[model samples]
Target: MRLEKKVIIVTGSCTGIGKAIAKRCVAEGGRVVIHGLEPELGQEVVQELGPANAVLHIEDLATEGVAERLVAVAVKAFGRLDAVVNNAALVLSSNLHTTDLTFFRRMLDVNTLAPFALIKAALPQLKQNRGCVLNIGSVNGWSGEPDLMAYSVSKGALMTLTRNLGDTLHREDGVRVNQINPGWVITENEARRKHEQGLAEDWYKDVPPVFAPSGRILWPAEIAAAAVYWLADESGPISGQIVDLEQYPFIGRNPPKN
Candidate 1:
């Protein structure tokens, strides 16, 4: 029970990595506020975690004042806020020519700006409790594939935000901020996305070793396991760090040639 008695707010908790983290928090004895746009899915997650361990809040992160509402929900349900996990994102595909101003702005609004808003809204409580913020980013933030221009740009900006606040907040307010950049993970949406892109239903099963060194990509539960450390007191005084959760070294790696 690393997070015993702590109260956390996890955005996008209706599915994928966010749901996994919420489940893990409950397993570790932490209560959570589950936030997402899907009411049905959010209710399901809240049910799965049980009413005593979770509360549901449905809202689009891009909507004005949604961040403040999420913070309010957490405090109302649990009486206090200990941490926040910014796991929601818009993962749309677009290239230089395909991504227009509107599309790019939408991506940034949801992916980057929303996290900043939530952090700001939760700042007072976080500082009072000496709590933390964990931003879920993507490995593509470093320099993404050609087709992921807007998404990549948004994630890169999020990375910078994480580092900047991680340092300043820890120094001034004693609230730690950090980030985790995950590689491709096998989530429900990812499977459906691959099928829509014309891959076989079992495409993930035969992923190339270059992409899946362990013969498979990551699982949401695996990422959740790593998240526990940062949320718990065991991580002591560490802030402003970005950890890349991938099977192999992401930078300066040479794949074998046939």
Candidate 2:
């Protein structure tokens, strides 16, 4: 197993890419602490991963002290942390005019501020263990998405946080840090919601599934594999880097430029 004996903390493990990452980490011989708001689903994920491989944390990460609570729990249970994947996110897709301050602030708090607090609390422990950190950024972090202004801004700030922390850790301590920005991945619930909202066409046309030059939609498993690979590998040479899961042409819907 690539990650044998490693202890991994993955937020948002109840569903989607986060769930897949938690499972994959366990399957790769890592022990995981799964975090989410849904107690039942978190327990279900841990159960699905079997006894020794998983545990659960029901946390509203947007709260100020939630990260400290999560870290304390993980350390109390596992004794030490080998890696942390900041995957929990609360998204708000609103234009400037349509968006309210409350909605925007909440998005920033959840998507960006939560990760910052969690990492800060985990830093001393992680530094002691020489552990690594992986931030779940978004394609919106690197590119401009007008529809999701608040979410995009938060993700962008998340990238900045990743870079700043990565640099500090890599230089001062042995800790490594990186960010992963994934493309659109369709889940059953997401599809159903879109269909209900009469936005099926929006999803279908917008999410092209071709990889790299293919412009295809990203699968959750694909992003999970990247997470698995990053933590499981020991070289850990990459710090302060943002790994964009979208291999598609960054400029247009077409293949790579010749």
Candidate 3:
């Protein structure tokens, strides 16, 4: 019951990592506002977490006023907000040649700008409660693959936002801000993405050593487990940090050429 009676807002929570975090928040005795684009999926998550523990909001993060609405939902339902997990992202494959201005803008809108907007919208409540923020970034933000140019750029901007606000917000408002860059995680969307890319059904099981050093990629539950510490009071005044959650050192690691 680390988060007992606390209220949290988890975006993109209808599925994937966000869903896992929402569930974990409930398991730890916290209330959550589950947000996503799909109404059916959002309703399902609300049902799973139960009406008392969770509420559902279906909308695009890029939409104006949606962030405020989300905050309103949390405050109206649970009375106060303790934490916010910015996990909603638009993951698309685009290279220098394929990424147009609109594509890049959309990427930034959802991945970077939306998080900033939400943070700003929730600032008052967070300040009142002395709550924290957790931004879910990706290891791709470091350099990224060739085909992930726009996505990578968006994440890179988010990393900078996390660092900038983490320091200023923590010092000024006593609200901590931190980010976690997750490696390859086997989520439902990832599985479908691989299949859509022409990989076989069991593609995750045969991942290369360079990608899955532990013989398998990460699990959503594992990320959620690590997330609890940051969200809980146990973290204690730490801010302006980016922790990469990968099996190996992401910055510089030369794998054996077998």
Instruction: State the C-alpha lDDT per candidate.
Output: 0.94, 0.82, 0.94
lDDT of 1 at 43: 94
Those runs of model 3 whose alpha carbons end farther than 4 Å from true positions after fitting are none
Question: 2 or 3, which is superior by lDDT?
Answer: 3
Residue range 14-125, candidate 3, lDDT tens digits: 9999999999999999999999998999999999989999999899999999999999999999899989999999999999999899999999999999999999999999
| Segments of candidate 1 deviating more than 4 angstroms | none
Cα lDDT over the full model 3: 0.94
Provide the lDDT at 220 for model 2: 82
lDDT of 3 at 211: 81
Q: In model 2, what is the error at residue 211, expressed in angstroms? A: 10
Clashing pairs in 1: none
Which 10-residue span in candidate 1 carries the lowest summed lDDT?
249-258
Q: How do all models score by TM-score?
A: 0.99, 0.90, 0.99
Error of 3 at 57 (Å): 0.4
Q: In candidate 2, what residue range of length 10 has the lowest lDDT sum?
A: 207-216
